[model samples]
Every structure is written in structure tokens, then in C-alpha cells.
Target: MQIRKKIYWSLCVLLLAACRQSPPPSRPNPVLQLREMGQLATTEYELSKVVRARDEATWYKIGERRMLVSCRARIKAGIDLSQIRDIDIQAQGDKISIKLPAPQILTFSIPPENIRVVYSDVGLFRTPFSQAETNAIMQQAEKQIRRQADSLNMLQKAQEGAAVFVRNFFEQAGYKEVTITYRYQENAS
Candidate 1:
């Protein structure tokens, strides 16, 4: 009976050990292991503008039609760290550097619930602006925001934010000084 009890307890212990989950494998780069650090390190520049979008379908005075909708759009530009590469990061004794990706439009949203149709004008025999029309106008507004990105200095702001984030991270890692830089990918749209 004693021998049987000992065997049963040993089997239970082995079964429990087999059922335990193993730890996830670690990657080569410590920064990559930080999961979403790149995202956390992004700088978002917000721009709000009131856009006047007009569309005309006039040809030879044959049933001319024009539509207009004025809307306010809030655009956000930032970098996404989920696209980070190992080569973009480098570290040495008491010094570290990271090359962040270029900044781009992160979010372009016109809240339907809060879309304030300040003004609208439709041509004769034309229907009023619908939700779909509003959406299309919002797309144009997004383009307008993109056209103004350079003027707003979004790229510089993004770079500053990336540098600050990386600097802090390295400092926490026991580094005396850190330098952060950015490398825009070719055709980074």
C-alpha cells in the first residue's frame, strides 16, 4: 500500500510539471522585446482646420451641378514603431542612438456624430449633402492636412519626441548620454 501511494504521488507531480507553461523565447534585440516602445515613443501633432470643399459637374451648360460642404477636420501625424527594425538601433558604452522612422498621418477622423455642417449649397435639382458626401469631403480635407504638414513642422516635432523618448530609455538603462536620430525610408508616404 505504501509503495502504491508513493507511485501515485510521483505521477501527480510529473503530470503537474508537464502541464506547466514555458516562458516565451527572448529575441536578440532588447528594444524589440520592449513591445510597442516605438509606438509609445511617437510624437503626435494635431491640426484642426475648417475646409471648404466644392465639386462641380458642369459641362457645356448641360445640367450643371455643384455641391459644397464646409467641415472641420482634426488630423494627427506621428510615427508608428511597429515598423521598427533592428538595424535602426545602436548602442555603445555610455552612449546609445536610435534611428526612428519618418512621420506620417496616423489618424484622419471626422466624427459623424459631431460633424457640424456649418454650410452647404447644392445646385438646382440636386439633393442635399448625405453622409456619404460628407465622408468624401472629409477625404479631401485629409489631403489638405497633408499639404500643410510641412508648414506645420510636424517632422521636426516627431523627431524631437523620438529623441526624448529614446534618451529617457537609455538613461534608465544606465547610460550617461544618449543621442537619437531619424532616418526617413525611401518613398515613405
Candidate 2:
């Protein structure tokens, strides 16, 4: 009877060990995941700018030439995740802290189809504005759109959106508390 009891106990132990579950697979590092995201564009805006240029009739010039051009630009702003370093992310238990680069305009484009010649005036003595001249004016308009990005609060909105996204991402990754901060950048608009 003792031998039978010993055999049963051994079999029970062996079964328990064999049925034990294996450890789950390790997950990718959160910091590496963020870095792989490249740039996270959070906000997009379609903006329009009108530019007018007048070449006054000077002593050397025959007559005045004035042109008005309008252009629509698409701007995308976000944090550059590629700039995220390993040290920028810290995880302890269920809490995580991350430092991100300041948001900036990621893309600014003026599609040719979106440009319009709103108005054009050419003096009788002055030749009509050349295609090259029109292109130069459009370039100037693009620059103006870039400069206005700050005033339009695009960076601010992008920063807010990035913070929300990071927070939600960490939370979904099982982090209970997520703290996000930004590193200041010069000319980050």
C-alpha cells in the first residue's frame, strides 16, 4: 500500500509540472517602438495666402506691372519620433515617463493645382508677367505661409495632440501612469 501511495504522489507531481504554462513572449521595447514610428503627424491644416506685387514705373522702367496670386498650402505638424532616445523613455512598474522633442511643421506643400491667379494687371507699356515671374511670386507666398505657422497655433495644437497620443499609447501598453514632456527646440515651427 505504501508503494502504491508513493507512485500516485509522484505521478501527480509529474503531471503538475508538465501542465505548468510557459512564460509569455517578451514584448518589443517601447522606446524602440516609438523611434521606429519616425515622425508622428498629429495635425493637418489647409491654408491659403494671397500675395500681391507691384513694380512701380521707375525712371528706367517703362510702365508699372502688378500681379496678385493666391496659393493654398497644406501643413502637417508633429513630433519627430526618430529623435527619441532610449534615455528619453523610462518605465518603472506600471508608470512611464517620456521626453519628446518639441513639435514642428513636418510637411508644407503648395500643390500646383491649388494655386490660382486671383487677379493680374499689366500696364499697356509693360509686358505681361512671365511664367518665371509667376513662379517667383508663388515661392514668396510659400515662404509667407511657413512664417505664419507659428501665429496659426499649429505647433501648440500638435504638441497637445502628441501628448494625448503618447499617453494613450502607454496606457494601452499596460502603463497606469504616463507622463510626457517636451524638449524645447529653437526654430521649431
TM-score of every candidate? 0.54, 0.69
Error in Å for residue 58 of model 1: 4.7
Q: After best superposition, candidate 2 residue 133: deviation in angstroms?
A: 0.7
Name the 10 consecutive residues with the lowest summed lDDT in model 2. 28-37
Cα RMSD, each candidate: 18.8, 27.0
lDDT, candidates in the order shown = 0.66, 0.87
Tell me how many residue pairs clash in candidate 2. 0
Predicted structure 1, TM vs. truth: 0.54
Question: Residue 108 lDDT in model 1?
Answer: 53
Instruction: Find the candidate with the highest TM-score and give its number.
Output: 2
The lDDT leader among the candidates is 2
